[model samples]
Target: MTKLDITKTNRAIENLLETTENPRHRFMLQAYYRHRYLEIAGRYEEIFAPEMMVENPVYHFHALGLNVRLEGQDAIKNLYREWSETGECVMYADDEEVAVSDHMIASKLTGYQFKPGKVLAAVGIDVDDENAMYIYKASEEMVWPYDDRCRLVGEDVWEVDPDKAEIIKLDPADVITASDARTMLEPLIKPLPPYDEAAMRPRATAR
Candidate 1:
């Protein structure tokens, strides 16, 4: 995947939503787009809004021969909060394969995570200066399951090609904390209609 471009990536999701016609698929995509926007803004509450996800959502994460399963909203939210404390930002590449169905959506893409050198080193990455920043690029596959109401059930993610992952040291001048990125990107988020289960459901047709 190419270098991370936050503006381009968010715009691609908007374009996809505009071109997609299926109601169910559109519901799922809307939820996902909102999730992505809020995530970059570090708005965890909005990302996990009551109408957007189930009560006991689960997350399966796999990487470096380690598998961790987090159950329930609090667990997942805390995990994200912990990552935020380190001031990291994640960018999803727009040129990736995506498949949407009635109850699930799957995608394979290369993702880049920008983290401070301290955070990277704690994860076993060698760093010359703890104050420096680095980018970790990896191939990622995600499976998102949605309930009948279009609420996300859970996320199943895998770092499929861990061996190919690259850690690149960033130039000092290019370094930006996640907090700064949130401020820069929050303005790009657009408001959408609240999630309505009745509106998203398929209505019965006349014979």
Candidate 2:
């Protein structure tokens, strides 16, 4: 994956959100902002690996402040206990309106594709690209799973339940809408900052 200039992207997004008028345009801007957020959060496997819980105790997706706390043995015990009582894992969707299916939850546990629309709704937007057709088709890959209880397994592998994953496939019309939105609002989007020479300087070695 190519490295992204996050600071620049954030600035540009802020600018776009500030000046955009058309609803579609605003949506596309929000999409890019959401994309940047995920990129900084790291890949799904790295963030949700079970082993990470031992050291960090909690994996916090900073961009959105959504986190999963790992309580070691206590967590497993509680999960089993809850399952015994309720006959299901104790999981909740970010949006009450968006139901969490078994497949969705399992997918999250197994490091499968996670959709962002539900979480974005928490920040005040309702988006679903289920047809995999959006104007800015380039961003589809940036989306990742947002698990409430991600258990990491090994260095690069995770033990996610395929049942818990949510898929957001966008149709061709959706893509056109997204693109039209961006075009209408591009002028309002924020421009990136100029380069800083001092910050780019190499460190001096000790004599």
Over the stretch 48-85, how does candidate 2's per-residue lDDT look in tens digits? 22422233332222122233443444553453343323
- Residue-pair clashes, model 2: 42
User: Highest lDDT: which candidate?
Assistant: 1
* Residue 160 lDDT (model 2): 29
Task: Write candidate 1's Cα lDDT for 1-207 as tens digits.
Answer: 233556555555567777888777787887887777677657777767777899999999896345999999999899778766665635546456777777888887777777788877777877888888787778889899988778889999899778898888888666556676687778776665666655567444212
Off by over 4 Å in 1: 1-3, 196-199, 202-207
Indicate the residue-level lDDT of 75 in model 2.
55
| C-alpha RMSD by candidate, in order | 2.9, 18.1
Prediction 2 global C-alpha lDDT: 0.30
For model 2, state the Cα shift of residue 19 in Å: 21
Q: Which clashing pairs does model 1 show?
A: none
Residue ranges of candidate 2 with Cα displaced over 4 Å: 1-162, 168-176, 200-207
Candidate 2: Cα lDDT at 7: 31
